[model samples]
Target: MNTSLEKVLVNVVDQHGAVYTVDAMCERSNDEPNSFGDCIRCINIDDEIIKPSLDLHFHSNKTGKVFKLS
Candidate 1:
């Protein structure tokens, strides 16, 4: 199986509806890495919900314009 690496911004919610977001780098083979689950288990982040950021962006030094991180 080939492994892939990706950078993602994940949003996590707690039981109390409190929201927390984290930027994570993940590596996966055959299946996507469970960043949200790992974040919940390893960190103190809440697991009420997990969603990928739709507007994830990065700036390029050459273009000087913001581009999606996909």
Candidate 2:
């Protein structure tokens, strides 16, 4: 798979239901073998680069399931 760094737009929703669109740097790979391709590196929020934690848990609204990020 070919890997490259890409700039992506990410939509973030706050606790107060405020949504913000931000730019993030991510490592992207071609989906030759599998579907998983992008890995987020850092998010640019208010001119600051913030590295997010990968150990967080996410709840899916459609599936109503909790998934852990590895």
RMSD of each: 13.0, 8.5
Model-by-model lDDT, in order? 0.40, 0.55
Residue 29 of model 1 has an lDDT of: 59
- How much lDDT does candidate 1 score? 0.40
Candidate 2 lDDT, 1-70, residue by residue in tens: 6978779887655444556677767676675443222376665666656655554323334433333322
By TM-score, how accurate is candidate 1? 0.34
**Alpha-carbon deviation at 44 in model 1, angstroms:** 9.8
Looking at model 2, the pairs that clash are: none
Candidate 1, residues 1-70: lDDT per residue as tens digits?
5766566565544334545565555555566445433422121122222222343333334433333222
